[model samples]
Target: MRDSAAGVLLGLACGDALGRPVEFQQTASIQRRHGRVTEMLANGAHGQPAGTITDDTKMALCIAQSLVESGSFDPDDVAGRFVEWYQSGPFDIGILTSTILRRLRNGDAWDEAGIDEWKHLPEGSNAGNGSVMRCAPYGIAFAGEPDALVTASRVSSAITHADPRCQWGCVILNATLAGLLAGEKQPLTSALELAADAPAELRTACEAVLSIMEGSESATDLELANSGYVVTTLQAGLYHGLTAESVEDAIVEAVMLGGDTDTIAAVAGAVAGARFGASELPDRWLRAIDETAEIRELGQQLDTMEISFPESIVEKLSSGQFDLQA
Candidate 1:
């Protein structure tokens, strides 16, 4: 369990670092400049170091630490942690999320933070990959209970993103985590089919992903997948589910995919790490991440908190037989 959580955190950070350099660049541009971006780079738009992580990894650790500390999903605490985290200014955060979190800090009710209405911002204001990026922890924390996973994902995402697409993206990630933790090796198509009964908005996004992935022959076939919350999250989960032969392979494949690379890698790494555990992660790669001890401590806390769930559930989760529908 400790190793699994460590793998999840380390995978997320490594992916973020690997993807940071080519974040918004086209694949051709990235290939032209960096030649595959297998190693971490720094000082792009943010002027950070080689192994520095972005909001994707930062927010994921925040969520993991919050859940580990509280032992359950607490939106208010999560919001508080997010605000405090941003105030410290670790990475680039999205405008909508920053605005919503600021409002929450100023005493806005959780629901009033523009959770249910698209009109909360402009027409296209709601659907970034921010929510989906940090959502992997929810999947890890609620590995056995689909309802709890979906509900906690909704709660965590609603603090910033209100679009059904964003929320549903979280659901897919959580479902992926559940399946991965359960040791189920269903194809991406079959796994998504299990979520066919999800909300209409989510189903639509999943259908779009299905179309892109159905006939894919090469890695580039995934380029058709969008970087937005809906498409990117599903693509990340699918790629993580399909391509990963090891933890390092998962992180590398996710980072190399290009669009929304950091978030995609982070989300994919989370699921893959959970499925494979820390021992499967390369020692050199794990040693390369920034703040390894902090992330590992957070992982320990998360593991300790698993005691809140029933013992049988925890055992099944550790054994990779936890039921997703449960």
Candidate 2:
């Protein structure tokens, strides 16, 4: 359990670092340029060092830190951390996340900013993987508490991504991560069961992944959607992470899928890491990331620490009282 928990964060950093150089490049371009992006390279997308991570891993670290520090999912604390990071001006923040964080920085309440921004945006323009990319920590902290995990995951996403897809996307992904950390026989399927009330499109995407995994469909036949859309990102990440035979293959394949490579791979890496354990992550990739040590430490902290949720939140979760309106 400890190794799997540690693996989740380590894998997230490795994927972010590995994919940092090739973000936004198409699969063919990635293929033409580097054959398969199995190693970390510098000065590509964000012009950083080879092992540097972008907003994907950075925001994840923020959430992990908040969770570990508060001993539970504290919305105000997580949003405050995000505001601090936003003020630092990360090189690669998603548009929706940037806007919401900007609002949060300008004194917008943590619960109101994302909801307002999401309400004003059109359907297609809303819902990014920004929240999902950093949501793996909840899987560790709430691994044993299904109802609390679902509520916390959704609420955490609502801090920056209020769209139903985004909220439920986080729920599904974290549920799957929790299941993986628990060594479930069919984690994704179990995750789907937990997310039965998720949006139809999101549930459909998950079902498709299940079909492919069950040998009822071929992944090659379907066009891999690596867009910023939450559903597509979740699908791509889950498919590669679950199907790939190794952690290296999972991250590599996710990166090679083109567009939103870093996020896709981060999501995939978390899953693969949980499946294989952080000890199995490529030593070369791990060494390149400067935050590797901190990530490992946080993972260990989250795994070993006794997670404590507030009594009010516990009662709310137990009563199925999910009020997203803030």
Candidate 3:
């Protein structure tokens, strides 16, 4: 479990750092330039040093560290942490996340802030991968506690995305990760089933993976849209993450598709990481991410966290007037 948790964070960071340089490049251009993109390279999209992770890994580290220190899903504390990180001036932050975090810093309650920000945006543009990209940490912390994991996943996403698709996207994604950590045979579908009220679109989206794993659906059979939309990113990431034979293959394949490569690969990396465990991750990739050590320590902390669904967490979930999953 510890290794699996570590693998989740490590794989996320590895993917973020590796795909950072070539984020929006065309697949043809990526292939022509770097071929498989096995090694980290400098100066492409963000122009950072090689091995530098972007917002995907950085924001996830915030969640993982916040969980370890608080030992519970405290949204306010997490919000404060996010605001602090935002104030630190990150190199990259999703537009929705930035607007919401700015609101949080300006004294809006965590629950109200993101929803309010989400309300001002157009429909399709509102649900984004920002929350889902950094949400895998909840899977480890709440591994065996499915309800707690679900609540955390949705609420954490509600910190920046209020769309049902966006919130449930995090739920199914983390639920799947939690299932994998617990050794569920049919992790993805099983997790979605656990959420009896999961959106049909998300359920249908995630269910596509079963056919994918069963050899009935080929990569060509599926239209893998590598976009910032929460659903598509989660779908593409899961398809690559579950189908790939290895952790390296999962991340590389997702990145090779181009267009939001870092985020797509980061999501894939987390899923593959959970399946393969930390020890299976390449050391070269691990050493490249600056957050690797902290993530490793946080993974160990999460592995040892007592399995308790505190009433406080439960109350927080039910306290909000807006039904996040609805």
Top lDDT hit: 2
User: Compared to the true structure, candidate 3 yields what TM-score?
Assistant: 0.96
Greater-lDDT candidate between 1 and 2: 2
lDDT of 3 by residue, 59-129 (tens): 89888878888877777888888999999999899998899898888888898878777778897788889
Worst 10 residues of 3 by lDDT: 316-325
Tens-place lDDT per residue, model 2, 1-326, is 88999999999888888988999999999999999888899899989988999998999899899989988778889999999999997899999998899888889888678877888998788888999999998888888888878888888898889888988998888889899988896899989999988999999998898898898998776567988999999999998888899999999999998999999999999999999999999999988988888999999898888777667765654575545642
TM-score of 1: 0.82
Query: Residue 147 error for model 3, in Å?
Result: 0.8
- Give lDDT per model, in order: 0.68, 0.89, 0.85
Please provide TM-scores, in order, for all candidate models, with all chains considered together: 0.82, 0.96, 0.96
What lDDT is obtained when candidate 3 is compared to the true structure? Answer: 0.85
User: What's the distance in Å from true for residue 31, model 3?
Assistant: 1.2
Candidate 1 residue lDDT tens string, 124-239: 55677788888877766776776667667765676787666676677787777667656665434544554565567556545554565455454554443436555555666566
What are the RMSDs of all candidates, in order? 6.5, 1.9, 1.5
